[model samples]
Target: MLLLAECLNQQGKSTQAVPYLNQVRRRAGLANTTAASQAALTDVIAHERRVELAFENKRWLDLVRTGKAAEVMTAHGAKQKRKYSYILPQAYNITSNRLLFPIPQREITLNPQLTQNAGC
Candidate 1:
């Protein structure tokens, strides 16, 4: 189902992606997709991935792949800080430097030619 939706989304067929998206939503006891625009549908798919795959270790990768890690994480961090005083107020500041992870130190040590990613 998601494969079909992803294909349609990639083809700029967000309207057609609705059915497959809705299939996932319905199985999760959520309502059908009512997203009107491609961007909105894209948001729906991202959200669905977050909810459906929570704690499976894919959320961060998904957000990063979709170029939404910064925007989503910043808002999520702010909300967390606001809702819980115990939570640190400092939120994740997503920047270009953060888009990719630094090269592993072990790997870099093994290969002297390897350069560390910027802002590690």
Candidate 2:
């Protein structure tokens, strides 16, 4: 169902993606699968993927692949800080430099041509 929704959305047939998206929503106990629903198709698909794929360790990779890592994580960090005053401000900083992980020291030492990623 997610595959069908993703294909439809990619083909610019977001309306067609609705029914497939709704299938997943219905399986998750949401009964409002009517075509009259007004949520954005992409958002619906993303939400479906997040919930359906939960705890499989794919969420971070998905956010990075979609180029939404920094934006989403930054907002999430702000929400966490706001909701829990004891949280440290720097705990969830999601800067551009964070988009890529630092090269491991062992690998860099083994190959002088290799350099660590920025902000490591």
Candidate 3:
């Protein structure tokens, strides 16, 4: 199902991707996708991936791959109104450095040719 959705998305056929995405949605007891725009459809696919693949350890990588971790996480953090809110300001900064982890110091020391990643 996901393979079909991804193919259609890659082909710029978001409307066609709807059926495949909806199949997953329906199986999850959720309503079928009804997005009319490519961006909206892409969002639907990403959301389905999150719901359908929950706890398979893919969420963080998905967010980074889609370049949405900062925006989504920032918005989500803002919604929290309790003790957790205090950490939001310092957390979830979506910088270029944040996208990739810094090369480990040990690895860099072992290989002088290795360069440290930016924002480390």
Candidate 4:
């Protein structure tokens, strides 16, 4: 139910997603928030998902599946660079090609038709 709500919200159907999100809030014993706009609702959903699923190793996959990898990671990278001078600027350069896993060299060698993902 939570995942369905998130998918609907991410796809710009926040109105339709609200009921599912509310259901999740009720189950989790959290209060449902009233967002003024679609974007706000989307943010609320993302925040809930982040906190609810913390330390379960789901964040990166969620960001990538929702097509928010580049935008979120780029901003995170900038913040880290500013907060810690030792952090390299290029450490989190999240280009579109970097959103996917690269094909293994062994797999590609075994299958001539297989090609590596971009930015591998």
Best by TM-score: 4
Tens-digit lDDT track of model 4 for 3-108? 8887887788888899998888888897777975878887888888998899999999989987898999999999999999999867999888888899989999
Q: What's the distance in Å from true for residue 27, model 1?
A: 2.7
Q: What's the TM-score of each model vs. the native?
A: 0.69, 0.66, 0.70, 0.77
Highest lDDT, which number?
4
**lDDT score at residue 59, model 4, on the 0-100 scale:** 95
Residue 20 local lDDT, model 2: 84
* Tens digit of per-residue lDDT, candidate 2, span 1-120: 886787788788877888888877888899744444333666667777998999999889879877899989989999999999999989789878888988999999999999889999
Candidate 3 residue-wise lDDT, 1-120, digit = tens: 865796798689887788888888888898887788877777778878887898899888888877888887767666663457457466655666777888999999999999999888
Better of 1 and 4 by TM-score: 4
For candidate 3, what is the total of clashing residue pairs?
0
* Clash number by candidate, in order: 0, 0, 0, 0
| Reference-based TM-score, model 4 | 0.77
Residue 95 lDDT, candidate 4, scale 0-100? 87
> Model 1 over residues 34-91: C-alpha lDDT tens digits?
8888877777787788788888998888878878789888898888778888976554
What lDDT would each prediction earn against the true structure?
Answer: 0.83, 0.81, 0.79, 0.87
Model 3 TM-score on a 0 to 1 scale: 0.70
What residue runs in model 3 are displaced by over 4 Å at the alpha carbon? 81-89, 104-113
Q: Could you tell me how far off, in angstroms, the CA of residue 118 lies in candidate 2 after the best superposition?
A: 1.0
List candidate 1 segments past 4 Å from native. 83-91, 105-113
